[model samples]
Target: MTEHDQQTDGPGQSFESVWDAIEDTPAEAANMRMRSELMIALKARIEARGWTQAEAARVMGVTQPRVSDLVRGKIALFGLDALVGMASAAGLHLEVRVSEAA
Candidate 1:
């Protein structure tokens, strides 16, 4: 890679990967993506348990349509707080940790 590209990517990181680092995105966009990913993961877990959206809604205290939206990756419409609440209601605890760059 060119020196400019290496510098742009920070040290030796490459942009050739299909999806590279997005961790440094602005707060709003990062939260949006995080919420979306969490929703998808939660929906998958619910399905893996062989549960219907209606059942999941009952467990999560949300309407079935909300669960459907999550399953469909319309995550931008929901906030991280809402997702965290739903996850807890659905018997999933959200765990996150921050560490210094390694």
Candidate 2:
């Protein structure tokens, strides 16, 4: 298959969300998805500032190991509230948007 075809799912092969295609329950998948997004946002902020994990820890008020976990995408090791707190400490704004499922 060509690269274009490989990149695009055909017909019913497409998944609405990564969670929908995984083995997790709907709620667990939702939590995982949210954590993943938060991790990406936090990591992006850290990288955008050219900060090391130690610097991120200092800014986010967490230890270096914790910052390492966040940077490494250790979703299971973090909760939504904790990530939100870290994001807040990093001077990032959190916004929740709700819309009907497609």
Candidate 3:
């Protein structure tokens, strides 16, 4: 891999989820995980439709800055409720599951 393309794992390489990999507290990690997943889904949907960030913002009923944040994966700038609302506005169905932790 090129220098820029190479990733140095550190200890987080052992974990599956980004939240878990960073060793966040359980609640914090779960929150971050959900935000990350929603952002990814939203970005994918926008790309699938060949929409620019401005178009995505219009469709999601959010400002362009908000769409930029979502596109850039600024997880800490969003909460679950906001993400859920955006998903709904985007006509995306979200299925939430709860299970015992491994």
Candidate 4:
């Protein structure tokens, strides 16, 4: 593919991420990206501890089905607040950094 193709879905289109391509706005894309990152971290943490969904749910103070949704990456089913709370309950420390966009 050419540089243009790499930058766009078609002529005169551009996106920085898959979320950007699919989401209606830059803010939505950013939200999805952050949620995805958090979900991935949580899933990895659970796996690294060899925890089943039930075990993870207990540790995170959520239901086993909720843990299943998390591990399955059901991003639409979770909001940032919920994910952050779960992360906190799992003993994970989180920091947010912001800088001007390029």
Computed on alpha carbons, the lDDT of every model, listed in order, comes to: 0.71, 0.83, 0.81, 0.89
* TM-score to true structure, per model: 0.68, 0.79, 0.79, 0.88
Ranking of predictions according to lDDT:
4, 2, 3, 1
Best by lDDT: 4
Candidate 2: what lDDT?
Answer: 0.83
Maximum-TM-score candidate: 4
User: On lDDT, who's better, 2 or 3?
Assistant: 2
Query: C-alpha displacement of 70 in model 4, angstroms?
Result: 0.8
lDDT of 3 by residue, 1-102 (tens): 421232436864544555664645878868777887899999989999898988889988999999999999888899999999998888899898999987
Task: Estimate candidate 1's RMSD in Å.
Answer: 6.4
Candidate order by TM-score, decreasing, is 4, 2, 3, 1
- Candidate 2 per-residue C-alpha lDDT over 56-89 given as tens digits, one digit per residue, 9 for 90 to 100: 9999999999999989888889999999999999
The parts of candidate 1 lying over 4 Å away from their true place are: 1-25
lDDT of 3 at 23: 44
Among all windows of ten consecutive residues in candidate 1, which has the lowest summed lDDT?
Answer: 15-24
> What is the lDDT, from 0 to 100, of the residue 49 in candidate 4?
92
What is the alpha-carbon lDDT for the whole of candidate 4?
Answer: 0.89
